[model samples]
Target chain A: MSDNSNNNAYWAANMRIIKIFLVIWFICSFGFGILLRPLLSGIAVGGTDLGFWFAQQGSILVFLVLIFAYASRMNKLDREHGVDE
Target chain B: MDQFTLNLLIVGATFALYIGIAIWARAGTTSEFYAAGRGVNPVMNGMATGADWMSAASFISMAGIIAFGGYDTSAYLMGWTGGYVLLAMLLAPYLRKFGKYTVPEFIGDRFYSGSARMVAVICLIVASVTYVIGQMTGVGVAFSRFLEVSNATGLYIGAGIVFLYAVLGGMKGITYTQVAQYVVLIIAYTIPAVFISLQLTGNPIPALGLFSEHTASGQPLLTTLEGLLSDLGFATYTEQHDTTLNMFLFTVSLMIGTAGLPHVIVRFFTVPTVKDARSSAGWALVFIALLYLTAPAVGAMARLNLITTFYPNGTTEAPLSLEEIQNNEALDWVRNWEKTGLLKFDDKNGDGNIAYVANGEANELTVNRDIIVLANPEIAQLPGWVIALVAAGGLAAALSTAAGLLMAIASAVSHDLIKGQLNPNISEKGELLAARIAMGVAIAVATYLGLNPPGFAAQTVALAFGLAAASIFPALMMGIFSKRINNKGAVAGMVAGLIVTIVYIFLHKGWFFIPGTNSFTDADPLLLSIKSTSFGAVGALVNFIVAYLVSNATDDVPADVQELVESIRIPRGAGSAVDH
Candidate 1:
């Protein structure tokens, strides 16, 4: 691929993955954590329901994973495109 | 030793250690002063960033807010930590690739206009100064509670120490000191939490302990908590109290604002490269999550412990007598907090017993939520040393964040305003002198504002987040995301966003945050039924609209600025930022 097309391809791929991750972020925090909390109230975890767990603890853990996943994957993308510093 | 002496010794030693680090890591160059020579390790940067991010509000009052507000307060936890995903994915790597000394420097370059940079500086200073006041007040409270000194006295002492280290070593000293602070504070925070968790639920991890069954009731902890709270006429532990739209908007505002704060944003500049900036954010969140996860547990467990202390047999049993409240060992935390006058008791019916309930008429005990974390060790009957350590931790949190804000303020004046805008030919020595002088000025201003603090002291952190979300965040995000936005669009957007958010805040809060100046109270806010804290998200929407709508009429960014955006995005050839 030409340099222009290659860079475009890389960016397109990155954005696609970012879009997917953003949905996960939304679901974990704003979705299950807040808006849909009542829906999951019946399904109990240790004490509270799944939504309460997601709101307080699970979202943060998911956030942690999302960041590391983004970083490692982006680094891999950079190497594939000969952009590695 | 007495608790007072122990508090003094531990706090005193921590200060000496910070000063010693400041002296050893003293910055001789502007790069060192501003960006710590861009050589910090990812893990260390993460730790420093964690310490830099969690202020006295998080360390001292977060649990208190959560403990009182219950699950509704999860917004603070989710709001604060959730922003990191935005930072790491959207902002940090690009800013690191742009390789600048300061946040406004990026704005100035991206817009190719000095006026745009000036607007950013205003947004930064407003949010940061308001935020700093919260830290100063937190310092004052920690000092007053532990040292038995007045709040104002503690604030001045804290400011003086910050001025010394910040003016001397700059970001270099701050980085190492914050690392040490992270260690002290995390330990101080977690020890009491672990003890309390083990005490209540037979689970050592506070987060898991929250889910474990309460040993006394042999029921799940939250279920038991809901029962006790209902008996007292308070909101249940697991139900939502705030309106869904308000909660949703408020969380969005805090998340965006946490990502946008200039002090937090500038920390990424100290890392080595784009990759490290991304990784450091993850590490930073990991360190921060250690506290955020534990905070809710601390809130719930402490509430459980407190309520159970009052009603030993159950909610059906007779409450503690006034004499028992005064004499009981578990009640010592209440008495100690009573000295601060934040905890109060009155037998209104002449019943003589402490009739504690949520009933407006008969409730005799009035306890401020801010006392929860400060009094946690005492509530759990942890040792005196742990109490002293918490005092040190509160100081560490307050001072580290203050130092970070002072640096942000100083660099904006010396680097962006003076060096970049006014005197392009200024020498390194002259710049260093200006930076130190700027540090002095910033401290004086922050301390003055802190002393005569605005009405938003309790929610000042919220105010800061709102301003950031409404103004700087949109401008920065658009500058990278859209090539069509030129200087006029960016400037208009920032000014419009900032004015709208601040006006909304001032309308509910008094103008200039003076108590009587507010036209409306939070109980009855104007427009869309939104609270002042939630308006930032709306303001952010306004910013994007004005920017795009204005940009349609205005010229596109020049070719060089467009290329700069493209370059920042790729992140392949990232290198250490050197002064132009």
Candidate 2:
């Protein structure tokens, strides 16, 4: 492939990963935590429902994991694309 | 030792430690001053970012807000932390690869316009200055309550300490001092929390203790608290009260705002490489999560403790009498807080007992939200030293954030405005001197505003977040992702977003935040159930739409700027931040 096409491929792959993670991000916080909270109200975790847990604690933990996981994934992708500094 | 003397010793020791760190890490060059010589390790950068990020609002007020707002306020916890994900994936690595000293430099180069850079500087200063005023006031409150000094005296002392480190050492100084501050603050925050957690749930970790069974009642802690609060005619602790649309928008506003703030963005520049920048954000969220995860528990537990104190035999029994509050040793926290006038009691019906009902007429006790965290140690009956440590931690939180904001403001004035625009031919040393002078002026302005705070002092955090989300975030995001967004499009988008958000805020919060000039209130918002704080997301949507329409109508982006976008996407050849 030409260098331009190679760069395009790398960018596409990175965007794919980001799209998946963004979905998970939206699902955990805005989805489970807020909008669809009533749907999960029947399933209890500790004293409250799953939605309440996600809102107060679970979403924050997921955010930390998402960031770290994204970092490592990007690092691997960078090396694969010969873009590692 | 007495509590006041212990507070003095601990607070004094922390100040000396910070000054020592600042002196050791003093900046001698423009590069050192701006980006900490690009030598900070990613993990260290994370810790420093934690200290820089969690302001007095986070340290002193967040738990109390959550305590009162309950499930309705989880937006804060999610919004603040979730923004790190956006920063890491969308902004951090690319900005690091581009390699600049300040956020505006990236915008200026990416959009290929000085006008865009100037607009960014305005948004940055507006958000940061408003944010700093809260910190200065938090410092005064912390000092007066802990060290037995007057509020004005505390403000002056706080300003002097920040001046010594920030003007002398710059970013280099602030970074190391932030690391030390992070240690003092996290320990100060968590130690009392552990005690309270153990006391309430027989669990050592405060985060898990939130989920564990309440030791006293043999029920889950949250379940017990909810039952108690409901019995007293308050909203259930685990249920939502606000409109879902407003909550969603508020969370979105805060997420984008956190990603958009210039002070937080610039911290990414201090790390060595693009890879480090990506991971550094992860590290930052980790350190921050230590406090963030604990905050909900602190809020729940403190609320539980407060209610149980008022109604010692459950909500069905008589409340604590005035004589009991004065004579009982365990209720000393109430009397101490009472002297500050933040916690007040009035027997409206000529009842000797303190009534804390949900309704206005029957509720004789008016308790400020801030007292929850400030008096947590005393309420839990922890040792005097622990209370002193919280005082020191509050100051650390306020000071570290103040220094970070001062750095952002000083660098924008000296580097972006003065060097980039006005005097492009100035010498390096001249710019450094200008940076120091700008920092001093910013500190003075921050202190003055703190002392004579605008009517919107309590609402500054929301305002700061709103402004940053509406104005700065979209501009930076577009500059990176879309080569088609030309200079005019970028400038127009930012201006539109800023104007709409600010006008919305001013309409509800008075013109220029002065009292009695508002056409609307948050309670009866101008928009359809949308408070001004939640309008940033809408403004951001407007920015995106306008930028796209304008970009399509006008000239295409130049060929070279396209290459710049592609280069930043890849991580190769990332280097130290350039001076220009």
Encode model 2's per-residue lDDT on B375-471: one tens digit a residue.
Answer: 8888888999999999889888887888778888888988999999999998989988898888787788778877754432334676788889998
User: Which residue segments of model 1 deviate by more than 4 Å?
Assistant: B24-37, B168-174, B423-458
- Weakest lDDT window of 10 consecutive positions for candidate 1 chain B: B450-459
> Model 2: how far is B534 from its true place, Å?
1.6
lDDT by residue (tens digit), candidate 2, A1-85: 4878888889999999999999999999999999999999999888999999999999999998999899899889988988888
Say what the interface RMSD of candidate 1 is.
1.0
Give lDDT: candidate 2, residue B579: 40
Give one digit per residue, the lDDT tens place, for model 1 in B1-580: 9889999999889878876776666645544644552676788889989999999888988888888888787888899999999999889988988887788989999999999999998898888877887777677678768867555776787788777757765443447778889999999999999999988899999999999998878999898998898998887878788888888988999999998999888778667888888899999999999999999999998898888877877888888788987788767777777776667888888887787798889898887676678888887788999999999998898878887887787778878888888898999899888878877876777677666555323466877898999998998899877889999999999999999999999998777766678888777789766889788998998989998899889897899999898888887888775542
Q: How well is candidate 1 docked (DockQ)?
A: 0.81
The residue-level lDDT of candidate 2 at B180 comes to 92
Error of 2 at B182 (Å): 0.8
